[model samples]
Target: MTNVLIGVDLGGTSTKLAFIDENGHFLNKWEIETDKRDSGKYILLNIVNSISEKVKELKIEREQLIGIGIGVPGPVNFETGLVYQCVNLGWGETQVKEILEKETGIPVVVDNDANVAAIGEMWKGAGKGTKNMICVTLGTGIGGGVIMDGNIVHGVKGAGGEIGHIVSVMNDGFTCNCGKKGCLETVASASGISRLAIEAVRKTKRDSKLKEWYEKRNQLTAKDVFDALHEGDQLAEEIVENVTKYLGVALANIGSLLNPEKIVIGGGVSAAGNALLAPLNHYFNQYTFSTVRISTMLVLATLGNDAGVIGGAYLAKTYGDHIRKIKHNSYIKELT
Candidate 1:
């Protein structure tokens, strides 16, 4: 019987299930809307049912499944397979591995979604072959992953890649969800760009198309800023420029600290492409330490939405194989 692996990508709004062979080829996949109205426990049952049905349809046996892996949108204690406080998902302190194991009767592992994405990138995406890499997602808030020598730097409390919370300003500038002032996320994220655009428009009073776009209220988004930039709105241009500058500086600082070979940027804001990358590169050159300035390449993430599933499968294969080997050896000793 061929050994198989199952991976679950548990996001804030949706959950994706993917099955892969030992060699990482896909067998089947599906998605479901996340049920966050109640506790996350509800969705856990949904995941188990879906995976079991798929396995039966595909004629895959219990022994064929080496293990299961999960990627969650929160901090994860990989050693214990626990999810810690996913604010977006509206859950706190859940035992992901235990519940999944009880429901599916398979060994389970879990890790943060962003961290798993980084591992996927390192394994097959933009960071292939390189041992050190950093992955950053520039959405509403900046999300990040750090890898050193093919291992995630999960830190003591699994808060290693909260790069968004890193201090960008010592003085009172802006508040962050982590209860800090002037975090890098405040200046480098999608919401940051929108906030900057709003502030810039108020100061300049520019009679541009941007002002007309949000005529009723101050409701604006990163997409609106990008659209305004495309339309040659001067205020929008200024906001994007500042955003690029600060994000570049933050990347430089991260490079200095980790000395990674590459930094892969993803998420909604990075869709701006060269418009953002050009200015960021300009400032990145100015701020980075000499060694990192020469070594690191800032590239866009290539994996897209598949990163979490792919990385989860990778973990399931590696960690599961180890456990299987240990069990086999122990059984042989007992027999002897």
Candidate 2:
């Protein structure tokens, strides 16, 4: 029987699962809607049932599965597998690892989603071959992970890499979801870029392609801003400049602290490609200390949406041995 790992990425809207081998090769992958009904009480049951069905479909014996690794959309206690909170999933203070293990009879490990994604990138994506790195995901909001000497830094409250909440605008800044103002997320995320673009059009008389695009579409996106910038619209260029400046400065601040070997940018906004990286790199260099700038390379993340599941798989493989040891001890205790 081949040893396999089950990797789960639990999100607000959907849950992605994968079967992977010891060598980090994915055998199969699938997704299911997250049932947040009843405060997400059924989410783990759904995952356990789905894994059982998938194991039967793959003709893999249950014993052949070494363990399960799951990434949750909020802070997690790695040792206890407890999720602190997942506002999107309507979950609060849940014992994920214990419940899943009891239901499925499989050892389980859990971590914060962003941290797992960083692990995935380090194992197979842009950060491959680097031991120290930071991955920043710029989607609706920003998420980040910091890795040093090949291990994730889970701070006292498991919020070590919550880089988005870092204050960027000290005064007169927009309020963030966390209720603070001037966060980097307020100025650099996709939504932030669009918000800035709208404000710019409303306040300035500058002629911009984005202004026309927004007029016709009735809204703007980060992509629209980048498209306009590429078309030589000065206003769009200014918006991009402003957004990247915040991101670059924030990352430079992180660089000063961790001095990681690589800073990888991912998520929806990174699709702007070089249009985003050029100015970001410029500002990153300008703000970062010389030694930090010389050693660290800022790059784009390559794993895309698969990063979470892939990272979960890597976690299962890396931690399976320890999980097995714990299970064996428990069994011996029960026998005694």
**Candidate maximizing TM-score:** 2
* lDDT string, candidate 1, 114-223, tens digits: 88888877877888889899999887888889998888899999999887887766687688877888888887788877777777666666597667776766577888
Per residue, candidate 2 scores C-alpha lDDT tens digits across 90-188 of: 899999999998998878889999899999999989999999999999989899989899888898889988989999888899999999999999989
- In model 1, residue pairs whose N, Cα or C atoms come closer than 3 Å (at least 3 residues apart or on different chains), thus clashing, are none
Off by over 4 Å in 2: 324-336
Clash pairs of candidate 2? Answer: none
> What local lDDT does model 2 show for residue 32?
98
Candidate 1 regions exceeding 4 Å error are 216-218, 331-336
- Evaluate all candidate structures by whole-model CA lDDT and list the values in order: 0.84, 0.91
Q: Return the TM-score for each candidate structure.
A: 0.93, 0.95
